[model samples]
Target chain A: MKNLLIFGVGLIGGSIALKVKKDAIFDRVIGVSRHNGRSLDDFVKKGMLDEIAVNVEEAISTANFIIIATPVAQTKNILKKIYPYLNADCLVTDVGSTKSEVMLDAAESLGDKFDQFIGSHPIAGSEKHGPDAADEKLFEGKNIIITPHSQANKVQLDCLWGFWECMGGIVSSMTPSQHDEIFSTVSHLPHLLAFALVNLINKKNSKDQLLEFAASGFRDFSRIAASSPEVWRDISLANKKAIISDLTLYKKEIDVLVEFIDNSQEGNLNDYLSKASSTRSEWAEDKK
Target chain B: MKNLLIFGVGLIGGSIALKVKKDAIFDRVIGVSRHNGRSLDDFVKKGMLDEIAVNVEEAISTANFIIIATPVAQTKNILKKIYPYLNADCLVTDVGSTKSEVMLDAAESLGDKFDQFIGSHPIAGSEKHGPDAADEKLFEGKNIIITPHSQANKVQLDCLWGFWECMGGIVSSMTPSQHDEIFSTVSHLPHLLAFALVNLINKKNSKDQLLEFAASGFRDFSRIAASSPEVWRDISLANKKAIISDLTLYKKEIDVLVEFIDNSQEGNLNDYLSKASSTRSEWAEDKK
Candidate 1:
């Protein structure tokens, strides 16, 4: 009967909390947030968490595992505040999008006081946010990346993996640097593209044109751009290094596409479309 | 009651047929195809078309409105075959992705058979295809662009507008060149980008990395690349000029993004993000 303390009971945390309660995996699931009273009342009424506390010390006092699921910018401060209350046996992990920065922040804030700290990122979520918007199935059939430091003990790392796996995520371990590098290309760059597309059409001359005749293609490409600005801003700032690298690579690829379009002789045009089509087809086949 | 002849009973044409039938505006919805009885049989069985014909002669013998909704490459051939069957007062149009090449094809194929031939592009579709995928709601709240020549009669043009409006689409008019140019940037270029992204990942040394860890962002971004290669190839070839211009602009945007990422000055990062964000927001605001 392991006690679990979930901090910031928002979308990701609340979702996991609901699943844990339903599965009866945790002896006691304590949800801690600034508005813990509301969380407690709601959870009791809805039966999500067994207990809730606003104070960090009280919530984590008997907890064997702690999950920090706050926004990236707020994470460092929260880790610093919670460091003094965490026991030697307690395993602490997080669910942030960016990893390298959070790892560095955790190391700096927790120092020797925190023994078992791991960084985890669940590669799942819609553009929507908040506890109310979260679904228990959000993490099902999704990838959860776990970045454990070299100093992390096997017991704690295994526990963290088990917990994430229980939430219906397929857990894979990577270094914080690797996690940042991979997600920068797959996720961060795409969000940037969506945002940039939005701004491109937002221009004064394009306003009427876009409104009058923008198609489903444009709508689908721009959907994620409508996401929470605050969450994205923090992610961009935190994962700047890997995102920048991936952005450079993506630009190079787009340059190749442009060259084909710019030099559109029949021969060159044939080559361009064929190359793109072949490449896309093979890659698409691999996913299924 | 106006009579309509649809050349292809695939997704776009079939959906249009269903809507036209449901609206009760058209006197007859006739299907023409080389698929013997297969395609037309499905449409008739589903109650989309009033009748099915194996040859162009029987299909357009009485139709005042002829719609060539074949794949881009097949459009010219279909238009030519139907030209001899068309009535003197018939209005010829298409529901293809690319307009310029089709306009040229229509002009060449018809010669002097009719008073006017208009080109149309409905910006609506699903990843799914064939007559089975057709739905009356396919064009609901969608945009339809009509590329009418100066020679197009007011009656024919107005009829074309009313036709799409009846199918629940918001209609906008543009010249052939303008239609090609806009869609090149909005549809063709983004599609090429998706293809290129898929190719880049496929060419990576660690292809399994994508298999084990690729998330929804990568999945959605590359979804369009999964579209039929034949359809896309025709689109790429047909709208070469506009698609080329768009591919170039997209390259330039990507280059700018790369530069900011390479330089990594905190001050310049948000500029890229903001540019995309603003454009997408404006696009989103144009729901109609």
Candidate 2:
């Protein structure tokens, strides 16, 4: 029986456990979390796992596979607590938004004792969070990026990919730096923009009036601004350099657009329109 | 028997006509349009309309309700052409995004006959255009703003509201100026922002690379920018003053955010996040 133990069993880890339970690959599944542990009860109620461990050491003592799914800032501390009980052959991976910071933490805590520690991020989430919001198909058809350092072994990497595949993600691989740079623009900077716009609107002293008239445009534009402040604050600090660069680049671009709108020259309007249309059209085609 | 003459039988007009037909209200429904009039055939073949008329004068003669759903710039010319056929009692409304400009055009073209016109903007649409994309439920649970000049009668207003209610929209009355000012922020500016963002992305020489890496964030942010450029160009021009003002306001707001990020003070981050959360939470509650 292949033993699987999932740590920090919130939305991502709990979801992975649920998907893995659908198959006969794991004979025993265990979850370890620091919360009220209602998720464990819910998981059992849903038949997602066979057992729950009250502590990290007990969770990893007999596990063949371990997945750390916690906020990036919390992973390092949890890794230290579980290290003493982890087997030398226990394959390990994590689901953290920022790979570089978490990678360093993994190195410090897991060292060479663990079989492998691969960094992974599934680019799927919503404004809502928590284990109750967990969907077994959360990662299905979504992009899963894995960043394995030089020390990672092929056997462990293959097994990690097998786990992610079982969870319904289309797996891809990138270096930590590449992941940070790309997501900074595609995710982090956009969230910052939404938050900034919402703040500006609120400062107008017509927040209630504006809310009364808030249409679909404002709703969709600022949806991400409603995301958990703690998560974004951590992300904003962790990916600060890349996010700052992307934000600067976007501001400069918006300034150029402001110039064209102010001038109202038919030529500039047409130019912007054609460029925007072609770009959005191309992007629209690539959606999975 | 209410005779309904719908001009520019495109998505909005066709959908309204279909809804009215389904309710079995209008005694006669006729569609008038240009562009080879292919959409009119779909409406007639689908039994949404009783017949089609090629000329504005022919369609408007002896009609009780005239709905103008053409582009804002073209609306004036159509009104002028049909002015001779329109009776003093005939009620006129439009489905244009900008109300003030269209109202002005109607006032100029009709002079003494201007009393017949009531400017309207139904805030429901998809990026997809044409009658083929039209659905009977397009306006269900949507807001329709009716902007009437002082000359509009209560009977005419109530009848117009009744028509939209049957088509499944909550009707609200406002002045043309208010409609223009409010939508300039809520709808027009957002579309402009999306367009501008898309144009900026396209300017990147690494277009293909960006598109390949484009995730859900970029896709949703740029969705509105993918709308028809021809339609947007007219809207931007029609509501030029308000949209330009909004653009300026947005630029200033964004600049403040940029400065805050440049400073990188923790206090500033908290301020931005707090203000945004407070406003967005209120807005979200209003939406519910």
Docking class of 2: acceptable
Q: What are the per-residue Cα lDDT tens digits for candidate 1 across B1-288?
A: 577888778889889888888878788888886565454666677688888765557667677888888777778887787778787788888898888887888889988863568888888898788888998899888889999877788998998899889989889898888887777767776677776666566556665575456666666666676666567766776777767666566656656655655565445656556656665665556553
Candidate 2, residue A258: CA error in Å? 2.0
Please tell me which predicted candidate would have the highest DockQ against the true structure: 2
Worst 10 residues of 2 chain A by lDDT: A203-212
The residue ranges of model 1 lying beyond 4 angstroms of the native Cα positions read A1-3, A35-62, A113-115, A264-288, B1-3, B19-29, B35-63, B81-87, B259-288
- Give the least accurate 10-residue stretch of model 1 chain B, judged by summed lDDT: B258-267
**Candidate 2 lDDT, A1-288, residue by residue in tens:** 678988777788777887778766688888875675454676777787788776657668788988888776788888887778878778888888888887877889977664468888988775557677777888988888999888788888998887788878888888888888777766777678778767656666555555566677777767777777767767777777787777677767666655766677666777777778876876777663
Evaluated at residue B49, the lDDT of candidate 1 is: 87
Per-model chain A TM: 0.92, 0.93
Q: List per-prediction Cα lDDT, in the order shown.
A: 0.75, 0.78
Per-residue alpha-carbon lDDT of candidate 2 for residues B1-288, written as tens digits (9 for 90 to 100): 678998877889878887878887788988885766465666688898898876657568779999998766789888898788888779998999989988888999888888888888888887678788888999998888899899888888898888888888888999888888778777777778777766655666655655666677666666777777777777887788888777777767766765665666556776677778767776778668
Give the top-scoring candidate (lDDT).
2
Give candidate 2's error at residue B41 in angstroms. 3.9
lDDT digits (tens) for residues A38-154 of candidate 1: 344686568777776656686665678888887777789888877888888888889999889988988999999555799999888876667777688888877889999988889
List the lowest-lDDT window of 10 residues for candidate 1 chain A: A32-41
